[model samples]
Target: MKVVVQRSKQASVTVEGRVTGEISFGLVVLVGITHEDTIQDVQFLAEKVAHLRIFEDEEGKMNRSLVDVGGEVLSISQFTLYGDCRKGRRPNFMQAAKPDEAKMLYEAFNEALRAKGIKVETGVFGAMMDVKLTNHGPVTLIIESKEN
Candidate 1:
């Protein structure tokens, strides 16, 4: 499991010109799943994302977690994160899990985030989605469950 977390003032996901999910003053999470991912990976990453202290404190230091700021989450399924470009011009997507397995873990990951008492919104899995966000501070981080 891998995730790209970006702090945002606002964000939305649109599928086929229809907005499916949106959030204000929150984190936009792009999730990628591989064959090895499981419910445990979902659980671990969800907790870490909730507690990550990327928000700023009164002194302008980054010290507050998303929970501290009562932020929302706009989660999107993004298998392109796993694209392998080392070999040639064309990025290989073989590392991305098959849709069926990936969707299950993806849903579980979202549910895990919701379980953490934060409002979690998501893009439709396997759909072509257009994500828009005002990345606050441009604060972004890439996280991998394997590395943790």
Candidate 2:
């Protein structure tokens, strides 16, 4: 599992002119799953994102976690995160998990976040989506279960 986490002031995802998910003062998490991913990967990433201390505290230090800030999550299924571009100009998605398996792990990740007491929103899996966000502090991080 690979996740691109961005702190957003506000964010929304639109699928076919309809908004699927939206959030304010939270994180927009782009999630990618590989064939090797399992429930363990899902569990690790969800807990990490929930507790990441990317938000600022009263002293203007980045000391607050999503749980402390009462932030939400806009989770999007993003197989493109696994795009391998080491060869030629074309990116290969062979590392991305098949849709059926990816979807199950994706849902499980979201459930894990909810279990940690964070409100979560999501984009339509396998749908063409347009995501918009105002990145707070423009803070972004890429987390991978393979590294954990």
Candidate 3:
């Protein structure tokens, strides 16, 4: 499992001109699952993102976690994160998990976040989506379960 986490002032996802998910102030989490990913990976990432301390505190220090700031999450399933471009101009997506397996893990990840009392929103899985966001501080981080 891999995730690109971005702090956003506001964010929304549109599928076929209809808003699927939106958030006022929170993180836009692009989640990617690989062939080797499992439920354990989903559990690990959900916990990590929930407690990530990227938000700034009163002293202007990045000391507050998403839980502390009461921030929401706009989770999007993004198999493209695993695209491999080492061979040629066109990316290879062999590293991405199959749709059925990926969808199960993706939903599990969201459920884990919601279990933590976080307001989580998501885009339609396997749908063509247009995402918009005002990136707060442009603060972004890439997290991977395999690294752990």
Candidate 4:
């Protein structure tokens, strides 16, 4: 499991010219699932994301977690995150999980976030989505289960 977390002032996902999911004052997550990912990976990533202290506090210090700020989450399934580009111009997605398994893990990850009392929105899995966001502080971080 891998996730690219971005702090966003606002974010939205559109599919076929229709808005599917949107949120404000929260984190935008681009999630990727590999063949080895399981519910345990989902649980760990969700917990880490919720408690990550990237949000700034009153003193302008990045000391507040998303839970403390009462922020929302916009989770997007992005199999492309696993694209391996070391060989050629075209990226290879062999590391990305098959759609069936990826979809299950993606849904479970979002559900895990919602269970933490956070308002979680999500993009349609396997859909071609257009995501828009105003990145707060342009703060971004990558989290991977193997690194934990």
Best by lDDT: 3
lDDT by residue for model 4 (1-148), tens:
9999999999999999999899988999999999999999999999999999999999999999999999999999999999999998999999999999999999999999999999999889999999999999989999998863
Q: What TM-score does prediction 2 earn?
A: 0.98
Superposed model 1: Cα runs more than 4 Å off:
none
Per-residue lDDT of model 3, residues 1-148, tens digit only: 9999999999999999999999999999999999999999999999999999999999999999999999999999999999999998999999999999999999999999999999999999999999999999989999999974
Q: In terms of lDDT, which candidate is stronger, 1 or 2?
A: 2
Residue pairs in candidate 3 whose N, alpha carbon or C atoms collide under 3 angstroms: none
- Give model 2's clash tally: 0
Worst 10 residues of 2 by lDDT: 139-148
Per-prediction TM-score, please? 0.97, 0.98, 0.98, 0.98
Which regions of candidate 3 fall more than 4 Å away from where they truly are?
none
Q: For model 3, give the 10-residue run with minimal summed lDDT.
A: 139-148
CA lDDT of each prediction against the hidden true structure: 0.95, 0.97, 0.97, 0.96
For candidate 1, the lDDT comes to: 0.95
C-alpha displacement of 96 in model 1, angstroms? 0.7
Preferred candidate (lDDT higher): 1 or 3? 3
Please provide, for model 1 over 1-148, each residue's C-alpha lDDT reduced to its tens digit, 9 standing for 90 to 100: 9999999999999999999999998899999999889899999999999999999999999999999999999999999999999998999999999999999999999898888899999999999999999999989999999973
